[model samples]
Target: MMPGRNLRKPAPPAAPAEREVAVECALQLRRIGDKWDLRQRILNFLAKLFFPET
Candidate 1:
C-alpha cells in the first residue's frame, strides 16, 4: 500500500429514512409562520432538498 493511503472503505451514503427525517425537519421549520424570516427559511429548505451537498 502506498504511504498515507486510506485503507478503510468510505462511509455509506445517508439512508432514505435519514433523508426523510431531514426533509421533515426542514418542513417543520418552514411551517413555523410566526418567525420573521419565514420566506428565507422555506427557500433554504428547498435548496437543501435540491442541493444537499452544497
Candidate 2:
C-alpha cells in the first residue's frame, strides 16, 4: 500500500435538476371520528394476543 494514500477517490457531484411542485387540496376532518382510535385499538389487541402475561 502507498503511504497514507486513499484506495477509492470520492465520486463527482451530481448536477442540479428542476423540481416539480404539487398543489395539495385540504379537507377538514373531525377529531371524534371512528378512524382515529382504530389504530391504537388494533395495536393493543395485537399486543394482547402476542404477549398475554406482559
Candidate 3:
C-alpha cells in the first residue's frame, strides 16, 4: 500500500436546508410566467448540465 496516499476524504453530504432551497428554486423556475425568463432558465440549465464548467 502507498504511504500517505489513497486517503482522499469523502464528499460532504448536502444539508437539509440546501435541499429545501434547491427544491424551492426548481418550483420557482416552473412558476416563472415570462417566456424570456423561462427560456433563459432552460438554456442555462442545459448548458450547465451538458457543458463542462469553466
Candidate 4:
C-alpha cells in the first residue's frame, strides 16, 4: 500500500430505505428557491444518519 493512503475497506452500499430517504430529501430541497443553507443542513443530516456512531 502507498504511504498515507487509506487502507480501510470501502463502505457498504446504502440500504433501499436510505436511498428513499435521500430522494425525498432531494425533492424537498428542490422545491425551495435558495439552497445555500439547505445544502449544508442536508449533508449534516445524511452524515449523521449514515454514521451515527461518529
Q: How far is candidate 1 from the true structure (C-alpha RMSD, Å)?
A: 13.5
Q: Where does the lowest 10-residue lDDT sum fall in candidate 3?
A: 27-36
How do the predictions measure up, each by TM-score?
0.38, 0.38, 0.38, 0.45
Q: Candidate 4's error at 53, in angstroms? A: 56
> Whole-model Cα lDDT per candidate?
0.87, 0.61, 0.85, 0.88
Better of 3 and 4 by lDDT: 4
- Weakest lDDT window of 10 consecutive positions for candidate 1: 30-39
Top lDDT hit: 4
- Give the per-residue Cα lDDT of candidate 2 at 15: 43
The CA root-mean-square deviation of candidate 2, after full C-alpha superposition on the true structure, stands at 10.4
Q: Which lDDT tens digits does candidate 1 get at residues 1-54?
A: 999887998889889999999999898877775474877888899999999999
How are the candidates ranked when ordered by TM-score, highest leading? 4, 1, 3, 2
Best by TM-score: 4
Q: What are the per-model C-alpha RMSD values against the true structure?
A: 13.5, 10.4, 12.0, 16.0
Query: Candidate 3 on 1-54: residue-level lDDT in tens?
Result: 698778778989889999899999988877775667879999998998899583
Candidate 2 backbone collisions, by pair? none
**Winner on lDDT (2 vs 3):** 3
Candidate 2 lDDT over 1-54, as tens digits, reads: 989997998877544431111111112233444566887899899999999998
Candidate 4, superposed: residue stretches over 4 Å from native: 34-54
lDDT of 2 at 54: 80
**TM match of model 4 to true structure:** 0.45
